[model samples]
Target: MPYIEECIQSILAQSFQNWRLLILDNRSTDSTDSLCSKYLADRRIEYITNATDIGMIPNFNQCLDLCDTKYYAILSHDDMYADARAVEDSLTLLENDPELCAVYSHLNWIDGNSQTIARKKFKTMGKVASDTIAKTSIRTCRNLFGVPLLVRAAAVKGHKYESAFYFTADIDFSIAIGQGLYHYVIDRPCYAIRFHASNTSMRDFSKTRSELNSIADKHRIKLSVVDSIRMRINDWQTRAGKHLFYLYLDHFRKFMPACQQR
Candidate 1:
């Protein structure tokens, strides 16, 4: 609710003019309804308020179901596009490569007030094989294909997020969609991910870790013994990396004023 306006404004400011914006409100008690009502004047935007409060993953699946375009991207209400050409650039990549299932780019981490924290860049770019992506996802226990990714409609015809996993469903969905396809990676950061107190990932460390382990276990069954051993080593590395990240986040928070702790 806090950042929804920014999210919609970013979409409305896109260089790609032919895009449609769907605002699926999951029975929010906040000023979401009134706030979104202001945007209904734009013919490109459609606001749908759910009669009941469906959970997050189900709402995401509903978005997928409602999409009728040749290419689609899901933007979180709390996040915004960092670049106006985000959709245009991603669409160009998919247009050039028919075999690519989706095109994803790096993201900039932003604070609650939309202040840029850091730019997250990936070393690799261009066409990456889906099998390699699946393996990397399993090994790293992370969703390397972050949001604002434009996915081809035909590529993910009937694919849906796994409801069983809470925080890590995107990782699972990434693995599933990359089965026999390739994904295009753009070098620039196209999206801005917000870090705040209410974020699910920020709230629960143990649950997130548990979900990551479950996702890894589910995907690692087909791996060879050597790969499995490597995954275990990588898991430890990821854990250490996360621990260091939390330490850094804590240090960062200490310097911020108490009012801006979020």
Candidate 2:
């Protein structure tokens, strides 16, 4: 519930007020649904609760089914936008360039205490074309999660997140939607990733690993030998950094005991 509150306030604070939120409840045992239900008086949101726990992938598919707009953004429970200008910027890019299916900005990692820990930044070439990303697809073997991006719902017309991938479903979805000519990076910081004890990073490390391997296996044809080597390096750095971050932080150390020390 607290997670949902943080996300909603970020959206409501957006300089752009013309968006609707669709929350697809996945049979959470917690009071997640209750928190959203209380906010039903607000007409801008449309909430739907599923009878069974559809897992994350199916829940995302259901969310897509409920979308009635031209563009769509996925707001994960534990993450929020960093400021009021994010949506306005996203809308501007997406509407102006028909070739771009999505645009993303920098990501800021915040602690459970809401203190800044790190910022993930990207170098942007002036008026970068999504074609470069598409051309490099075969040479790019690693997957970058979330990445402060927004997607065009219309572009997702024939796509859906596969339920079988309980861990790396977002990776598969990104590969499919980015489609070589559509995903671009914005120049400013836009997304906030909150790290704490209750987050998914610590909850299913082993399963996540297996799922990541499965994703690479399924896309072997798209990876060059060089990209594969670079990907392995990037993968180790990402996971290792997460584990170390949680372990070093006095309060966060308890949140990731499930992670086997490497």
Candidate 3:
């Protein structure tokens, strides 16, 4: 709930004023309703509180169903747009190239307090091949594309986030979208993803890893011996990277009296 205001504010601050903001509350018990009520004055912002607590993936599907626009982007409650131009930049890409199914930008990792922990960037920009997106994601065992991703409604007309993949559905969705249509990439980091104790992936690391493997298998194409070895090595490296990230957070907290006192 503490982060909700900032998340809404980020949308309100977008350089592109034509977009609508949908705030979906999945029957949260906190002061989420009250907090979101403050933003109801804006006609563009719609707040919908579910009558019953639907699971996360269902909530995402609900949002997709509710979308009536040509292009839509889903912003997580804990995350925010990195800059005001995020919307404009993303929208421009889709507008210019009708062929692009979606356009995603790099993202920054931020702590609960919204302090930047790291920046995740990609060397490539512009139209990326569908096969390349799948191969790169598989090679790294990570989703190369991050959020503030603007997706075309027509491109994903019949698609929905697969409920079976609780953790890696985003990866699945990404690969699914790129099957025929191309996905573009923006060079700049346009989103900030929050890392906290409650993060789903962080909380269930092993399960998430298992799901990643399942996704890899489901989307498997013929791979060379070298590509196969790289996949295994990258998977291990991703696990180690997560451990190091948490260790760094712990060390940071130890030195900060404010964090220790809390």
Q: Pick the candidate with the highest lDDT.
A: 3
TM per model?
0.88, 0.81, 0.91
- Superposition error at 243 for model 3 (Å): 1.0
Cα error, residue 143 of model 1, in Å, equals 1.8
> What ranking of all candidate models by lDDT puts the best one first?
3, 1, 2
Q: Evaluate model 2: give its TM-score.
A: 0.81
Q: Which ten residues in a row have the lowest lDDT in candidate 3?
A: 200-209
Question: All candidates' lDDT scores?
Answer: 0.80, 0.69, 0.80
At residue 201, candidate 3 shows an lDDT of 57
Tens digits of lDDT, candidate 2, 1-262: 4688788788889999988888777887888877777777889987878988877777778878877788888888778989789988888888888877777787888877677778877555324455444324323323343453567877775888876666567666666666555666766678898877677544354455445556556654345667667656665666676567767765554455466553
After superposition, which runs of candidate 3 have C-alpha atoms over 4 Å from their true positions? Answer: 224-226, 253-262
Q: What is the number of backbone collisions in each predicted candidate, taken in the order shown?
A: 0, 1, 0
Error of 3 at 55 (Å): 1.1
Off by over 4 Å in 2: 125-142, 201-221, 250-262
Better of 1 and 3 by TM-score: 3
